[model samples]
Target: MEGEAGVSVPQRSRTGLRTERLLLRQWRAEDREPFFALNADPEVMEHFPATLTREESDAFAAQSEADIDRQGWGLWAVEVAEGPDAGAFAGFVGFKVPRFDAHFMPAVEIAWRLARWSWGRGFATEAAREALDFGFTHIGFGEVVSFTAVPNVRSQAVMRRLGMTHDPDDDFDHPVLPEGHRLRRHVLYRARSAA
Candidate 1:
């Protein structure tokens, strides 16, 4: 887990955004296994359709890195910068552009995919607030959005905690899911930049 374990030397990223408890740094080669562990955890991936194979997880991580390298910002491969989990790869929390077409076609989105051990603590919320600040302040985004199946209350709670608003009108059937799939119907939430 070379780079995946928490390293305390203040590992900075091309997309440098850090919170008091976490560092939203760029992805590293070492992140692969921990990421696979997160993806393979059924509880962590319950909101998703199924667990990803190691190859799929690696591909997903590669794509995330490419987005960061190309756009200068994407899902930040987060590390717990301090505390017991310090230097451990907690997971990712940052910005992304959903390529799928929908009513919210051109909006930037804030997202997270953290390891199960990182759940109870406020890491996701903590890191996400910084990501929101960076997106709204530095990146000049007007608004950011998040969505999950209606039953995904945990993530929705994070959205609400971020001061995002939801409207029934924004609820949508996920275009990527099959028509009757359980996770197909998603609730959308939006947050505006404080700027």
Candidate 2:
């Protein structure tokens, strides 16, 4: 399926979603190396509490792979589909169910984390739009939400580009983080299915 600007909608296969420039597919063994690199990069992990160790990153990838195997959708490993970087592991852009309890518990979040090299090319927004489409059309989600620390303007901008709306009243401190943590206060954005 195609969306605005010729972006392909996500297919409900284990292969996962696709867009004009990305293939949001299941994680691969080869992806672990670069995935760990990105996860360990302090710049890339700036918004999060800390960089992930190799074991943490591998476990994350393993869980992502298992999720796709069982549910046919999860945090997909994003691959560059064309150009000189074709087939490169740019990073991930897909849906995740927040494990922590919050007012928004039970919501599926549209999220992305790309390599520093992939920044500024609209990859996150492009792949996320396709993932959001999949969540609405394929998974039957009435509304999908995204949240990030208050300082994460970049992600918030991507959220806006996806036509998601932010309501300050809906914002809340992340329950996963301890009180007084700098990253605990997060901004929430929501988008409802057009259907």
TM-scores for all candidates?
Answer: 0.91, 0.92
Model 2 spans > 4 angstroms off: 1-11
| lDDT (tens digit, per residue) of candidate 1 on 1-195 | 112112211223364787888888878999999999999999999999999999999998998898766666778899998887789998899888887989887778899999998888988899999888877665667789999998899999999999999999999998889999989999999999666
Tens-digit per-residue lDDT, 50-123, candidate 2: 99999999999999888767666778999999899998999998777788888877888888999999999999
| Alpha-carbon shift of residue 93 in model 2 (angstroms) | 1.0
* Each candidate's clash count: 4, 0
Compare the candidates by TM-score and give the number of the best one: 2
Error of 1 at 192 (Å): 0.9
Model 2 weakest lDDT span, ten residues long? 1-10
Give me the overall lDDT of model 2: 0.87
